[model samples]
Target chain A: MKNYLENINKAFESRARLGIMSVLMVEEKVDFNTLKDTLQLTDGNLASHLRALEEAEYLRVEKQFVGRKPQTTYYASPAGREAFKSHLDALEQLILNNRQKD
Target chain B: MKNYLENINKAFESRARLGIMSVLMVEEKVDFNTLKDTLQLTDGNLASHLRALEEAEYLRVEKQFVGRKPQTTYYASPAGREAFKSHLDALEQLILNNRQKD
Candidate 1:
């Protein structure tokens, strides 16, 4: 159990962060507005969680301008992708362990 | 994603709590000492988490004495089992979503 739990990343514990990563997992790149709308998070809430993931190096941020407007985009880093995958694997193991007990 | 993430119980957000629930999901009843040792948590740490789970009504505690020594045991309440099952289902859905994306 410890072995299985160890891989579950604390970074993705927040549902917002989990939602962010889940989106990034399927999409190559997501802009700030798209993510905010998809996760239904306010700007501040989304920024903070995104910053947390960036600090963990699980996510990378790119700021660019589309015409006159500055747009921020997020991408799950290589490390982040690996870590999230391990976390999901751990979750799967825990679920499987329960079923086997049944 | 929102639908899947919504079912993850906040009570199991902590790794310690997750470990405790995972153990209880498999075993009918576990004593305090065994839970503490199995999760490798300090007495206070384990007690605090146990208290949180108890407050959430996810666990029921039974106390008695073996000779002069006191014993405390834990069992996952029926509600807890259902909640945890739902949480695990949400996790499985998240994992499957990722896999399907791949």
Candidate 2:
């Protein structure tokens, strides 16, 4: 129970943050537009959330010109990946514990 | 990636609801007051959330007398347990997929 609560709680510390982290957890890197579309978020909204993730050092943002247009791409940093892994492990332990109770 | 997004999204369909589910994912049965304390929720707030979970058939509530006072305890239903397990699996697959990318 302790393990379950700790993991789910950690994984859900921030709702939007978790969504972004979950997406980055799988994709090597995704463009800002792609993230915005996948999440159905407004430009400003996505940018703000991305900024928060960047500040947390959970993600890295790369900005450059893509065919003369400014493009930004995001990727999960090592720390971010580790945090996501720990969070998932906690959730798994919780499920296993529950099954044992049955 | 598809698996990770699906699991995290389902696990977090509702913030407060997820919290309740996560707690019940372990412990066999928990009393209302105990749940309240663990979640730091008000009586009314807890009751409302409990009612929602009850309606979802995700939990079973038993009302009985403990000594002289009425005691209400909650446990996850079989279906609820299955749902939680599926959710955890999704999260795990997501983590594994991410690790494979490294």
Candidate 3:
């Protein structure tokens, strides 16, 4: 069965992943160490999540050398923005639907 | 490692559960049918998620007889409110932290 809710992107169901998407949604792109420090995530955990999003093709990765040091940057792909938008729209709809009860 | 982010409740990470909380957070209380209609959730799916929150003690349920029929209403308990607040704070912090890059 194809559930409409399933399209909301379970990949971002995790707070960490959702946070990463939220960050990328606004910023043009963000680098690794900044994402780590900003999100207060451990190297392993952050990298793991980055890989997950990367594999999902929801994120665009740019590998560059900054002063002879490897620096990786992340961006939300077009599909990623669409998925996140749908996810947020689902949330907003939920909130909107319940407003009469509020 | 006891990461501070772990303190954020994972229970409401799902959109459905978070929607439930967001509804209860504002409404004094909501009944089963209302929640179902508002969330557009199936009976089994809604019941399971409700059970998950109930088990977490984040939700308060009041059962009574309305016209000889059983009626169940849900409320967000104080602890549930606190946990949800912390979760939202974490989200806000993530957005806040990334503003510099945005």
Scored by DockQ, the top model is: 1
Give Cα distance to truth, residue B68, candidate 2, Å.
3.9
- Model 3's DockQ score: 0.19
Candidate 1 vs candidate 3: which has greater lDDT? 1
Of 1 and 2, the candidate ahead on lDDT is 1
**Alpha carbon lDDT at A94, candidate 3:** 43
lDDT of 2 by residue, A13-82 (tens): 4545666887887788999988877776789978887887788788999989989999989999998888
lDDT of 1 by residue, A2-101 (tens): 8888887889887788799999998999999999989889999999999999999999999999999999999999999999988888888888988888
Taking the candidates in order, what DockQ does each have?
A: 0.70, 0.30, 0.19
Rank order (by TM-score, best first): 1, 2, 3
Clashing pairs in 3: none
Chain B TM-score list for all models: 0.94, 0.74, 0.89
For model 1 the local lDDT of residue B88 reads 80
Q: Please count the clashing residue pairs in each candidate, in the order shown.
A: 0, 0, 0
- Cα lDDT tens digits for candidate 3, A1-102: 023344446788887887788778888999998888878889999999999999999999999999999989999999987887777555444434444344
Each prediction's RMSD over C-alphas, in Å, is: 1.4, 4.0, 5.6
* The best candidate in terms of lDDT: 1
Q: Which portions of model 3 show Cα errors greater than 4 Å?
A: A1-9, A19-52, A60-78, A81-102, B1-7
lDDT for A6 (candidate 3): 48
Q: Share of real contacts kept by model 3?
A: 0.17
**Please, what are the lDDT tens digits per residue for candidate 1 over residues B18-41?**
899989988899999999989999
